[model samples]
Every structure is written in C-alpha cells, then in structure tokens.
Target: MIGRYAKLNVYQEIFKSSDFYRVAGGAFLIPVALLIGLMSNTAVIASLSLKELVLIVSVLVNGFPIIMEAVKGVMAKEVNVDELVSIAIIACMLTGNYLEAAVVSAIMVAGALIEEAVSDSARQAIESLVEMTPDTATLLRNGREETVKVETIRKGDMLVVRSGEIIAVDGVIREGATSVDEASITGESIPVNRLEGDDVYAGTTCVDGFIKVEAVRVGEDSTFGKIVQMIQAAEESKTESARIVDEYAKWFTPVILASALLALLFTGDVTRAITVLIVGCPCSFLLAGPVTTVAAISRAATEGVLVKGGGYLENMAKASSLYFDKTGTLTRGEPGVVEILPEGGRSAEDLISMAAAVETGSAHPLATAILRKAGEMSSSIPEAREIVSETGRGVSGMVGEKRVEVVSSDAYGQKGLTTVEVRVDGDVWGCLCMEDEARPMATKAIRDLGAKGINDIRILSGDREPAVKRLADEVGISRWHAGCKPDEKLDLIDTCVGSGLIFVGDGVNDAPALKAADTGIAMGLRGSDVALETADIVLMNDGLEKLPFLVDLSRKMSRTIKINIALSFIINLIAVVLGFAGVLTPILGAITHNIGSILVVALAASLRYSKG
Candidate 1:
C-alpha cells in the first residue's frame, strides 16, 4: 500500500508539472462560467442549467485536491489550513452558493500552486549542486585507460582527467600540470594552477591541461558530496520562527473551528460563520517565515555563502560582535619569506634549503611559505629524517648529518615579523622572517561591518603580540588578543556569547572557537576540514569581502521576515474582524484570505532579488 501511494504521488507530481499554466487556465475559466450562470438566458446552449454544471465541474476540479489534503491532515490528527478551507468550501456549497465555492477553491489552488513554484525555484539551487557530480570517470588500469562509472572507482585508483572534463573524484594530481576551475566547490571564479602533488577536488573541471589524479575520496565521501549533503540537511532543518508558526497553527486551527461554531449559534447566520472559517485559514502566517528563509538561503548559496540552516541565519543576523582569526581568516593565508638571515657565515641558500627540508612534511601555512620559497629559487632541498612537530612551537628533524630545528621567536618577545629560529646541532644558526599580508579586502570588510552596526570587531591570533597587533592596526580592528592558544580563543568566544558573537577562522586550531561562537564562518577554499565542519557558514571562495556582504544579507533577511509576519498578522486580524461583523461574505472572505497569502509570498520572493 505504501509503495502504491508513493507511485501515485509520483504520478500526481508528473501530472501537475505545469501547475501554473493549468491553475491559471482554470482560474480564468471559473469566473466566466459563474458570469454565464448568472446572466445567460439562452435555452439551447447558454442555459442556466449548463452554466451551473460548469460551475460544479470547476469547483470539483480545483477543490478535490484540497479536500483530499484535509482528509490526510485529519487522519494524521493535525488541524491545518487545508481543513479550514475545506470547511469553508463545504459551507458555501450547502448554502446554494456554487459561484462562491468555485471561485474560492480556484483562488486557493492558484495561490498554493504559485507558492510551490517559487519555493521550488529556491530549492533548485541545492539541487543544482547535487547534479554537478560526474557520472563516469576514465579509470586507468593495466597501463591503459577505460571509462567506468564513478561509483565503481575506489581510493588510490588513478583517473585520467582531460581538459574541459569535470574531475570525477577528490584526489591528488599524480601527473601533468593543469589549471582547474573550482568555482562550483570553492566559489573562486579564477582557475587555480594544479601541479603534481597538489590536491584536486571532485566536481571541479580541468580547464587547461590533462592530468592523472589518484583518487583519495570517491562518491559521497568527496568534498562536493559533503556540500550537497549539508545543503539537503540544512533545508530540512527548521528555524525558530517556523517552529513557532507551526505551534501557533496547531492551536489556531481549532480556535477558528470553534469561532465559526459560535457565530452560527449566536447570530443564526450560516454565511457569517462560513466567512469566519474562510478568513481564519492562516495561510499567510504559515508561509511567511519558511518561504523567506528558503529565498534568503538560496540567494546566499548563489553568492557562495552556505548557511547551515535557517536557525543559523537568524542567529547570524542577531550577532552584535565579530571575531576573526589572524592567520587565514584576515590574511590571505599564504605567507612568503621576506628575509632569510643566516649565522656563522652560512649562505642564504643553505639556510633556506635546510628550513625547507624540515618543513617538507608539514602542512602549516608557514611551512608552505618556506617550501614555496625553495621552489621559487629552484633549490634542491635535502631530505629530512625523523621529523617531529611541537604544537604551536616548532619542528625538528635530522638533515644530512646535522640536527636542524625551526622554533618560533615568541619565547624571545619578538614582534612584527613572524620569525622562526633555525637551530643546527643545538646552537641557533639563523631565523627566517615571514610575513602574511592582510587580505586586500580586509579593511573594507571591517569598515563595512562597522557600518552594519557591528562595532565590536576584534582579532584573535596564536601568533606573537606584535604581529597580531600590526595586523589589527592594518585591518582597522581596534581590539585584539595575541599569542592565544586554542583554549584561550574558546574562552574569548564564550565570554562574548552574551552579546552574540560571530567567529570566522580557517584552521584546525580554530575549530573549538568556531563551535563556541554564536555563529561560526569558515573560509572554505583553504580551511581545515575540522573548522569547516564546526562552522555554521562557509565562505566558499575564501574571500573576506563576502563577510560584509553576508552580514548585510542576514540583516535584510531578518527585516524581510519581520515585515512578512507583521503583514500576515495585520491582514488576518482585519479580515477576521470584518468576517465577524457580517461585512464579509464567504466569497469576499476567500478573496481576502488568498490575497494575504499571495502578498506574503510576494514579499518572501523579494528576498531573492534583494541587493544584500
């Protein structure tokens, strides 16, 4: 029976695929039929009986689905707007008001169909993400390549991706160099160059050259797959406003039924009671919050901001303070070696070569900087053995018959540059000074946040005080905390929770703080998995400019929601009062109720085009 019902639902959806056109056609014909029924006096073709038959047919065609929905709601023990509308239609029909019943049913169906169309457009944003995954891959096996299903490929399988082909799995480039367009996943419009050993993700396209990628994650475990999953989960999650509206509807439906009964008993007027039922349907109130949320979230997705859920969107709008991590959040996250000072007559080449050798196995931004410097100079760095890293301090390894260590200069109270001391055989040899430049839009983002009324913008960093302070000054942030461990950042987030804090970071150490904040935003392109998982929002392109835009967008969404709710309540109150006063007939009540629903839907749809 369940399977049969599912099949029936599928068929129903298929039949209603062109719902707008069908509903519009039906709505246009309904009033014409009613007018003919009232005005026609012809005996042969335009007879009164023929017009009455047309009205009855129109009412059944438009109102049958609504009646079925009400029945389903009752079976599930839920009193909803459908039941109220069904009652109103039945009352109109019993009172010999076929015109009123037909028009009311047509309007309600048309309104619902329009709302569904708009909501479906918003949902398509997430659906598009799911559709981006490639179905097939060119799998390399036994010295030859053969096309195979992406699902059949396993980890460590080498896949040959040609230029203009979508990458089939998340992997590392094992051969060839290419520029991959990762806009779908990272939201970065520019294609990034990928060489041997560079990571490539699924759903990205190879735009320039052919490359062989060794698959690391396939199917649903890939980064693209995870994003799709998150979006689906987000859509299913309800906001506080939606929950409140649902609770209100639960009690309000019964109250409307009772009020309708009271009107009939006290005034002995069937039309007034039916009007009361029609006006108290709560259609606008039910749609106001969720539709706005869907449109806002869909708009955010199009702009490369992925809000986890409507609840997070609401909290993000309420955030009064913003906290940013220094390394990768405010800065470009790619630091470069500014100066390599050697000691004991060591050449600059020797110093950098040794540093790069020890840093080869590390993925830290500073390590990447040293490795990048070595690559730029085309220097042959010696291999390091028995390498070990000390958390928040340094890395040590044995390089070519000598013990090498790169330690942070924080112990010496150094400021400004991020300096790392190189120790050879237990004596300090030299220090490599690196600088991570502030993001180009960092200042503008901060200023814009201030303009958005978020004055408590602060910086938190695990770097030295001088370096952090310098960056804070550069970015125009007035408050900063330097040399902060992960726990300290978490503490700061906890303290600021009362004021509602937004923490933005992109490192493993930032995960705890991200989870502690009211709303956590992660830089998606370069962020650690832990940080991304913990964050409430992900800036896919790793752009700081999007931060200010997101803040403004959240505020606009909040305002849109408020306006929609106010308009819905006001319309409902006025309609109900007029309904009780006998000023509204059943037909007028249905028109007013549907108008309120249409207005709320229009307001919610406006969020999709809002500038913010």
Candidate 2:
C-alpha cells in the first residue's frame, strides 16, 4: 500500500513537471475556448467575456514567464529579444489592446517551445548512442558464466556474448564464430562475420552464433564510450557562425529597442512602436546557425562518420587541399606476398618457413600476411628463439639452428617491390616482394573530391620514392611526397595548414600529423588508438567511399546555413518595414515574426534529409 502510494505521487509529480503536458494543455485549451466563443451568441462567462477571459489566462500562462525573463535580463544589464517581446506585450495591454497582447505572448511562447522540440529531436542520434551500451555483461569466470555490471568487467576478462545479445566491451573473439550487427557503431546495416581473432567493438550485437571475447578495452575506455565523449564534446563546441551571431545579438537587441523608441517619438503612436518591437526581435538571427549545424552533425553520425564538432564541419567545407598517408589511407594496409624469390639454391618453402617462424609473434601487417601465406601452403612453422624487432626496419630471431633475419630492401637502396630480405646466419637467403594493394574506391574518392573542387591532392608517405610515385599516379593524385618520416609528415602538414588541409591516415606514426592538420580523418577499423584520439573525424567502418560523401555533406550544410541566414534577414527586414509603416498590427507582427522563426528552423531541419 505504501509502495503504491509512492508510485502514484511520483506519477503525479512527473505529469506536473513535464513541458509537453504544459504546452499541450495550453495549446488545446486556447483553441477550444476560441472555438466555443465563436459558436456562442453572447460569448459571456460569469462577469467577463470569453476573449477577456482568454487575455487574462494567456497573460498568466505565457506572458508572465516572458516578463520575468525580461526583468532578469534587465537586472543583469543584458538586453535580448525577450525584453523586446515583453515590452511589446506591456505596451499592447496599456493601449487597451488586450487581445493583441495575448496573441503576441502566445506566439512568442509557442514558437520558442516548438523550436526547442525540433532541436531536441534532431540531437536524438547522439542520445541514442549513449543508450546503446548495455548495463550488464555475461562474464566467464573460472569456467562458469555469471552476470555482472559492465563497469566491473575489466580488461583481459573473458565475456561470453550469446546470440542476440549486445557485446559488452571492445574485444577480440577467442573462440567460436558469429555474425555481428555493428550498425550502432559503424552504421553498416549488413551484419559482419566475426571469427576467431576478429575484433568486436562495444555496443555491437552478436546476431548468429555465440562467442567468447577477450576484453581489450572495458568501461569508458571502450570505442563506444570514446565516441560518445567525442559527440558530447562536439555538441558543446560552437561554430564560427554561432560566435558571430552571439556578438551580433549584443548590439542587435539594443538597436531594435532604439528603433522602437524612435518610432514612438516620430509617429506619436504606441501601436506603431509596439509593432516595431514585436517585428524586430532577433528570433531568426539567433537560430540561423545552430539548427543547421545540429542537423548536419546528426546526419553525419547516422552514416558512421563522427565529426568532432561543428567548427570542424565548417572548416571541412572550405578545405582546399587533401593530404593522404599512402599505406593505410590510400592502400588497404594489408600487404600480401606476391613473389617469394629463393637465393643460393634455397627452396621457397625453406625461406617462407624460416621467415614465418621468426614472425609468429609479431603484430605487423606484413607479418600477418606472411603467416596467412604459410598457413595456405600447409607449412608448419617451428618456434623461434630470441626474437627482436626494430621499428621501421625488420625482425631477427633464431629459427631452429639457423639465425634468420627479415629486413626491408629499402635498407639497401633497392626499390622494385616492397620486399623483406630474408638472411640466414648473415647471408641473403631470399626476398619476399610484398605489395600493399590500393583500395578499389581510392580512384573514385579522388575523382569525386576533385569534382567537388578539391584539386590539390597529395600523398605523404614513408615508403620508397618509386612506390609512392606509382601509388600517386594510380590514385590520380598529381602531387606526391615520398620517404617522409613521422616528423617530416608533420612538417608537410604544417606547410599545407595555410591552405586548409584535410589529412587522412591510420598509423601510430600518423598521429602527430593528424593533430597538426586542419581536419584529420582516421580509419577507425584499423587505425592506431593514438591516431583515432588525435583525429578530428573518424570513418568508423574504414570505407573510403564515404570520404567524398562527407565532403559533399559539409558543402551542402554550409550552403543550407547561408540560405537560412539570408532568408531570416530578408524576412525580418520586410516585416520591420511593414510594421514601421503601420501596415502590420501588433497581432500581425507577432504572427509574421513567429512564421519567420518557423521557416528558418524548417529549412535547417531539411539538412537531415539531404543526400550526398
């Protein structure tokens, strides 16, 4: 009985506090009362008439809030549209135009409420991302499965994700096969097949088969958590246009107040002055940028592109040059052994077996390709001893009785294919010519970027000059820079900064360059965590096809914002002129002002449906 009473009280409190209920009640009550007043012959209720009762009710419900806010703004010495609207309502009431006062106040409150709803609805995409992560995880502990809060699931803990359940953390599948729906994270509608050793991110659903995932990142360190943080930060960071509007409002509000006073002195009519105040409020001006920005950001999120903020989106629209890291940005980053050349009468099997044995524990992309090739050949790799790796050079270890080393051919200044020279006991045994294949979408992405007016395309790579030149030509990029180290990449980015560069890369070495560029886009699937952290944007599914689409979307959003600003200015100007000329009454001025606000919001919301 106590619990039931408490539940009833909670329900009662929620209903009273809800803005929807308040707005809906006011909206419904006013129209129904107006209709009944029109139908009745006398339209009388108690001592007051129907319209008189409406004027009192509307003033109490809507005008009181506007008046209170206006008073606060004045006390703080900050002038705004609310002050102008409040003054207009007061003036109408003083001039025996109570109906005009009610209408103007109602319009102001209703327009603001509706605009808030639209903005809130547009931001639901980011909110949905926050809700995607489940609260509990099925943890595999000591050969038994137990449920625990996701926060308690630490790294290295094994999580058993059953079919039709959301994966609790970012991890690698240790056993079993499953198809995962990563649409919440990557926005890819088609479920991707995940086998042993394949990565599964947090918030993805296991759709087909059960799998045990060894957690790599748990809690707020997961990719989904980082994405949510990025989005929240993005929403808080304002764009250039928003800053301009804020500055303009400081003067615009006072200017409107001055115009109202001047009209009252010259025309000697309070109604004309009130009309001026009503039409001159900067409703459209305030909303022109943020609405478009929010819609564009939301749309980008739905397509698997996480833009850090509206400022980046604004900069991206004006990007003049595009810089790319050749290996992972343009190419697939997965190099495959195309030719295995044997030297000194050594068989191909002997060279591959020795190389694969030494590279068994390495996480390099080339090592992965070699291991895959060895598996395909049905060769059993013997364990290596005393394995040592040199960054950007090679790996050396003892394969059985022989000392084996796999070093880059670039170390000898020889360039044909990107080869790793296999040495046995300090003698060259053979070289494996590996090729990192260019993505099929690379040419199309470049072509589309050029079509969108981004002409200066360049490749800054650490690879040999011949390979870089070949890739640049193949990808239709005219400018190319080869043999760039990590610092050199940063230097190149510095030179392009003045021209607004959009740098795309996926390696740990690319992290510094990514941070230096005007806009950095990281390939989330295979990119280093440092690169993803420093990048301003992330292509979640690592699809280059979306590059051109992003550019197109940015340009479209820029155009839409400009259109909204211009439309708002023109509408406000026309309304101000009509109001000053006594052609627009107080009620008409309020209606026109509300209409302008609605039109601007509607135009900005249209960006949500725009196609690339």
Candidate 3:
C-alpha cells in the first residue's frame, strides 16, 4: 500500500508540472493521427502522411526547445548531451519513423520536466515562507485600525494581529498576550505563549488572543525575507563535485557522439546510431550533484540549520578541527547572577537594584543578567539617570543621589564566574558574581561531533582561564585558550588555517574568527547581528545539539552525491550498451534514459529524510 501511494505521488509530480500540459496538448495528437491512419489512411500533405504531419507538430511543441538549446550550445562552443538527443530526433524524422520520432521527443521532454520538479523539492521549505506571508495587515493608527498592504508598513508602525492570522513583520509586542505558532520560523510545533515585550517574527501565526506589535523589521528586512533570500542563494550555488561533473560532461558528450558516429559509419544502421544518441543524454549524471546538495540543505533547514550554500556543506563534511566560543554558544547564553556581596553595611538587594537601574535599557548579556536578578531579589528598582557605558568595560549612572557604577572585575578567577564591581560614588559597594552554564545538550553534542570525525575540539574566550577551563572540561574539550581578545581569536584561527576548520561563535568578538574559518556557524537565537551576517551557517533554534546533526548532514550529502552519480553511471552504461548491441529501439532507448534520470532524481529527493 505504501509503495502504491508512492507511485501515485510520482505520477502526480509528472501531471502537475506545467510543462506536462504544454507538451501533452501537442503530443496528444499522435494517437489521434494513428487512429485516423487506421480508419481513412488520410494524407495531410501530398508528400507527407497524416502521421508525419502530426509528428512535425509534436516536435515543434515538445522538441523545439531542446533542439534550439543544442544549436545554442554549439554556437557557444559548449558541447552538451542535448546535442545527442537532438540529433536522434532529427535522425528518426529523416528515416520517416514519424511515430517513434514524436514518441521519443515527448518522452525526453517529460523526463526533463520530472527532473525539474524533483530538483525544486529542495526549496519547498523556503518557498512556504512566501506563500504564508499575508499580503495585507491591520494597521493600528490614532485609535483606529486600517487594513493596508503589508509592504506599506515601516519600522515603528503598530500592527494589530489577532488569532489565526500570520504576523506580517518581525516586531515586539506592545500590548496584550498571545500564543504564537512559531513553527514556520523555528520549526517548533508547540505554540508558545508570548507576553508583552516579547519578540515575534514574520510568518508566525498568532494562535490565540490579540497583540499590538511595533514593527522592527519589515518587507525584505524581515527574518522570513532574509531566510528566503538565503535559501534561494544556497540553491543557486554549485558545489565542487558539481563543477567536476560539468567539466567531465563537456568531454563525455563528445565521446558518446563519436561512438554513435562510428556505429552509423561501420554498420550503416541509422536506427542503431539513433538508439545510441537517444540513450546517451546523461540527464541523470548531470542532475546528481545539485539534487543531492539542495535536498541536504533543505533537510538541514527543517532542523533549524540554515546552510548558506552547497559549497559550505561540502567544506563542512571535510572539517577535522572545530573551534568554539565559550559563552552564548556551548553555554546556554543566559547569564545569571550567582552571588552578590555588599559593603558599608548595605544589603545585597540594594546593590542589585543599583546595578539593575544603571544597566536598564542595555542589551549586554551581563547587564541583562543583572536586571533579571534584580527583578527577583529586589522589591523595586530605582530609576536611574545620566547612564553612560564604556565599551567592553562597564556602565555608570546616577541612581537617585548616589552615582552607581557597575565595572568589570577580576575578583574570583574561579570556574565560570563573571564578576562586576558595584561602586557607590567612588567607594566599592561590593561585587556581583555571574555564571553562564553549559547547554543541556552541550556534552552530548560534543561527544557526537567526535564520532562524526571532528578531531580537535578547542575553546576560545575572553573570560577568565578558570571559567573557560571549567566549561571546556564539562564539555570534554581538552584544548582551550582563555583571555583571548577579538584580534587574538582572529590570529589563533589564522594560525589553524586548513580546508576543514570550523569556528562557532555568537557575538561581535567572534565575528572575525568566524569569517576566517572554512565554515562559520552562528547561534541565531542569541547571536549578535555581526555574527549572524558574518557566519556561513546559522543554528536558528540556538541549540548545540544541531551541531552533530549538521556535521552528519554534510557527510551524508557528500556520500549521497557519490551514490547518485554511481547509480546514474551504472544505469546509463547498461542502456548505452544495449543501444550499441541493436537490442533497444529508439523509443525503448528514450524510455530507458527517462527511467534512469528519474531513479537518480528519486534517490536525491530521498535525502530529505536525513536524521538529525
């Protein structure tokens, strides 16, 4: 029953292709002509029979494009397999085998369309982003809601999204609460309850409740738009294996044509030569690399891993060493205040409130951690004024009458501790120790990477040596370098330059190393904009578990391409040998070629089932 359903789906693919209808309308006349010839023996032209006239029309509609491509290929000094099939169609016509000529042309055309449908299956996930995008959005303005085109929305525009509607832009909720089905964005099925101030992305459906969202990114700048663009770019990219196939194809087509010429000259059998031409298109071999690459990329996307291109997947499969950024990558990225110490008879709440007040409106991980602890430990956080922050150092502001400062500290060089001094006026009010724990799957992910052939696993960080070391040991990584500045990380990665080196990082500090590596993967959920833009691949779900999955995917893609090519070669070789032996007719040869291409395409499409 499963096999029957699968066969039905294949037939559906053939019928649904728009090319099918165009070719069918012309080719459908062949059977009608055959019926008329049997009934009346009618001649459309004085010198041509009805079957010949029908064949010409079918060739014009179904075979004309391929024949013109063959002509263009010759003019461009590019030899392609289309030339072989084109010559075969013309040969059948000259021999007055009109029925076989029309049949072969239609079959070849149908095969190409089927290949196209199968190849495009890779973009199905990305294409759904476009289809799910709502064209119009309800704009809330001056206490009234106006329905307008989503394209007209700009940054800062408030959008009122209700239950069952797809959010049209990436924005922050300003009012109310709702459960959003973020499956389109993150591939997580369970609808998540979103409160006021929570970030929402475009294409995520509002499951229930209502919210007024302030648009932050819209149109092409939206996350959905950027993802679509990335997937399209990935599909258009050609891998190294694909390039090799193209180079061989340039030489391979001529060899097949030479064999056909030899058969015609030696045996004086035009039918045998035509059969060889019909079977020698090499459609399966030509499509093997790209189909496998696209399928692998699409499969990876489903697991929330966005690969930038096929070349990256090819590069990743060969990676031997992996470099990691300690914070916000292998770690959960959410820093929490571990312990707070106060001086001058002050309570811990007072210090946390002062630090949180000054850190308010800051996006730094440390600042966020401070604010989060304040919300839990302190009753109320006083409003801060005149806040100023020094890059990579600390933040200072006027909290009430006293000047509060949260400056970087090296108090305890202990494992995973990040301390910041809380100063009241010029005197130290004490310090707050913070820690970012390793992700729940970090150890497992690292272990899996080793199995996948990532030999050298190293950690790079600006944190204290003890902190970096602890996290490294926890994740089973023995090689680690701490206190490395941005330029230092860049220099380290440069020294490790090789074909398969990968650097995983999450912030601006790691951007340089990411760009320097063979494949750079960014933690998309919490990654800085610089990191996201610089990295070649993004773990959209922000899970380290996907790392092993990604590595496995890349290797599998490499293997799948090889397997597909081998299958194509074996099938085509069998068909060509039969053609040379005069055992296959032109029609049978065309059918065999179509079957071979379809089999290869099916194998490539099966790559979508890759396990994460």
Candidate 4:
C-alpha cells in the first residue's frame, strides 16, 4: 500500500510542478482577461477601460515568471530566450500597447505550458520503472513468511515468491520450479522456466512459481537498482552537441539586441524595435538541442537501452565503421564442443572422457562446454582428483590410474571453431573443437545497421583466425582480423575514416578500446563490470537486437535537430522582415515567433513514440 501511494504521488508531482502550475494558470487567465478587457473598453467599468485594466493585470501576471527567469539567467552568466521575451513584454507596456504586451505574454506562456507538458509526460513514461520491483519482500525466515522492507533485505535471506509476485532480490532458486518473466530485467518478454539452482533477478515477476530464493544481492546492489541509477545519472549528462548549442546561445541575445537597436535607428520607429525583440525570442532555436536529447534519452531508457549521455548517443549516427568483438558480442558467450577428433589411435570417446574428467572441478566456459558435450554423448565421466587450474591455460588431474590433461592448443578444427587438446599419459590423445553460437539477431542487426549508413562492419578478435572468420561470415561482416590484442584493436580504430568509429565488445578485454572508440556499445548481459563501465551505450536486453534501435534513434535525433534549426531560422527571418516593414504588429509577431518553438517541441516529443 505504501509503495502504491509513493508511485501515485510521484505521478501527481509532475502536474504539480512549479513550472506547470504557474504556466497553466497564466495560460488559462490570459485569454479570459483579454476577452473581458475587450468587452469593457466600451462599458468603461470604474471609469477606466476594463479591457486595458485587465490586460495590464494579465501581462504582469504572465510576465512576472519570465522576468524572474531572465534575472536568474543574468545572475548565472547565461542569457536565454526568456531574457528577450521579458524585454519584448516590457517594451510593449512602455509603448502603451497593452494588448500587444498581453498577447505576447500569453503566447510565450502557452509555449512554456506545452513544453512543460511534453517534458513531464516523457518523464512519467520512464518513472514507472521504479515500480517493477516490490518494495516489500516476503521473508521465509524459519519457514514462516514475514514481510519486510526491501531495503532491510540482506544477502543470504531466504524469501518466498509466489505466482504474480515480483522477486525482490537477485537470488538462486532454492526450491520448486515454475516459469518466471524477466522482461523487466532482460527486456525479453518471454517467460522462462526456473528450476532449483537457477538464478532469478529482482523486478522479474514469477508467472506461475512458488519458490524460495537465497538472496545473493539486495537493494541497490541488485541489477535492477543499477539500471535505475544509470537512468537517473543519464538525465544529468549532456551531449557535446547540446553543449555547443549552449555556448553559442549567449551571443544570441546580444546580436538580437543590436539588431533591434539598429532597426529603431534606421526606421525611426520604436514599435519596430519592440517587434524585433518580440520576434527574436529564439525560443524555438534554443530548444533544438535539449528537447530532442531529453526525449531521445527517455525513449531509450524505457526500451532497456541505457545511454550514458546524448554525446555518446549522437556518436552512433555518425559512426561509419563498427568493429565487433567476436566472443560475447557477435556470438553468444556459451561455447559448445562440436566435434571430438581422435589421435594416436585413440577413440573419440576416450578423448572426450579424459577431457571431461580433468575439467570437472573447473568453471571455465570451455570446461563447461566439454562437460556438456560429454553428458550428451552419454559417456561415463570418471571422477578426477588432485585438480589444478592455470589461468589462460587448461586444467589437469588424475583420472583413475590414467593421467588426464586438457590444454590450449594451436591445433586447427572445422572453420571458425576453437580447439582444445587432450593428453593421456603425456602423449597426444586428440582435440575437441568448440564453437560459440552466433546470436539470433546478429545477422539482422548487421543488415539493419548497413541500411542505417554504418556499412563498414568488421570483427577484431583475440580468437584464432578460423573462429573469427566463421563468425564474421555468419554475421555478414566482410572484414575480420583474428588474434588481435586490445592494443591492436586500438591501432585499427585510429584508421577508420568518415564520421567516427564504433566498437562493440564485452567490457572485460576490450575496455581500453571501448574507451578509445568514437562510440562503444557493450553487451550488458554478458559484459563484465569493466565493459559496463567503459562503454558509452549498453544494450541491456538482447544484445545485437537493440543495436538497430539505437542507430535509428540517434539518426532521427540528429536529423530532427538540423530540421529544427533550419525551420526556426527560416520562420524568424521572415517574421523579422515583416516586422521591419510594419506589416506585423507585436501581437502578430509574437504568435509567429512562438509557432517555431511549438513545432520544435512537438518534433522532439514525437521521438517518445518513434518505436511504436
């Protein structure tokens, strides 16, 4: 109940924000006051023109916030459109054109209200992510259920999660088996079966399961918590384009002011100068960068793609060449032994048994693949004793009276498959070739990215040539380099031409390259902490499947920003010319000026629904 209220309260806070309320109230009263003032011009209420009286009141009311914002900008050494909008309103009043002042104030107020509404709605769309996990956990202490605050949950606490309940922690399923929906965690909507020893994450709902989980991570340490933190941090980070727009914005007010003064000197008309200020608010122009960036970031977050900043997101559209790490990026990290070849007159079964026994106590991916293949072959796996593992090498142990060893080998296998050499009693017994499966979306992502203008796709991997070549061909990539170390990848990154270079890899071995590339996208699920930290963008759910979406979003945002700039300049140029010719009144100039701003807001807000 408390959690429900908290989420509701947050929803309400958007409407109740200071900007929304002030602008909303003023937007409503401005029109009403105008109608009243127009009627009272003839009635002459209280021996004064009520139209003029109420129009002044409305102007002051709407103009107060604009003035305050302008003052704040001055104090902060920033000049924004508010400063010009405030000037236009003041100049209208000084010229005794109360109706122009009121109309101008009202138009700017309406624009603010519209912008506020769009921004609030975009924020509301992603804020519900916090509600994915329950605030309370049903603790299974001593086999009795006790509901406790999720924050109070600690590692190793056993919790009971039933069907229709959200799992409150990252844990191992200790008992029972049923289906679980990890869409909230992995972005895959399909519910998967969970058995004893299977892992479940917080925010994932139990579709039809009654299970007890032993918590391994609780509260902010869980994956869901980190995603939320990433979203919040992304909100504050800006793109390089946005920063550039802001830096150039300071010159706008000065240039506009100079233009207005020169207009008055040349035309000998005060109204012309005031009209220049009114039309030159530059509200739409200034909104070009920030509005688009906010909406794009918000849209990406809800789709399970967490972009660190607009700068990185923008880089994706500019990237010409995409370099991918073969393991865990193009291919699923789960390797499987595909073929068992015999040597020294030994049977394939003999080689499989020796390899499986030596790797029994190890947790490496290669070891797991060998064990899995042995099980499928229905071969009797012997228990190995005195096991020892070497990093970057293989494991060795005593399998009964026969000595067994599994070591890395340069031996070649079927094209693009990894090979593991097995030894029996210090003699070569044969090798097992393992293949990392290509992701289902790998080919599609490559093709889609090509259409999006990232045509030069390649693979730079530490795997042997055959493994790299096979994955490259499977994924439709033409260029590939095998056995390239991290430093070698950097050498290739520096050679890319055009807009930029984008590198996609698991964060572990590719951290330096990820940091060096123009844009780095990490496969979040299989990526290490180092990869997650180093990459600019993270594909949280299905790795390769999300790439096209990211590229689409970045390209659209860039195009939208350019379109907004062109539209704003064109509209303002025509309006300013008409104002100089006295063909546009301050009231007409005000409407024309803000039309551009409103259009920019709408274009940016549309990005939220682009995927749909």
Candidate 4 residue spans exceeding 4 A from truth: 1-51, 120-125, 130-133, 140-144, 218-220, 267-269, 340-367, 370-432, 451-455, 497-499
* TM-score, one value per model: 0.82, 0.83, 0.85, 0.82
lDDT by residue for model 4 (1-612), tens: 000111111334545667556556666665676677556336676755766777778777677767777887788886656777788788888778887787777777766555556655656445767667788989987768999999999999999989999998889999999799877666677899999999888888999959999999888878777777776677666666667767776787888788888889999898888888888777777677777776787788767677777777788778778888888888887998878999888888878988998888678989999999889989889889988888888888888888778888766654767788888789989989989988888998899889888878899988888788788888899999999987888898878733668889887778888888888888777643454578888777746878888888888888888788788778887888888778887888877876677788788878888782
- Report the number of clashing residue pairs per model: 0, 0, 1, 5
Is candidate 1 or 3 superior in TM-score? Answer: 3
Question: Candidate 3: worst 10 consecutive residues by lDDT?
Answer: 1-10
Give the residue spans of candidate 3 off by over 4 A: 1-18, 40-44, 75-78, 338-411, 419-433
- Between prediction 2 and prediction 3, the one with superior lDDT is 3
Assess each prediction's global lDDT (C-alpha) against the native: 0.80, 0.81, 0.83, 0.78
Clashing pairs in 2: none
- TM-score of candidate 4 versus the correct structure, residues matched by position: 0.82
Error of 4 at 182 (Å): 2.8
Query: Comparing 2 and 3 by TM-score, which wins?
Result: 3
Candidate 3 residue-wise lDDT, 311-387, digit = tens: 88888889889999988888886788888989999998888888899999999999989888887874488899999
Clashing pairs in 3: 416-467
- TM-score winner: 3
* Winning model by lDDT: 3
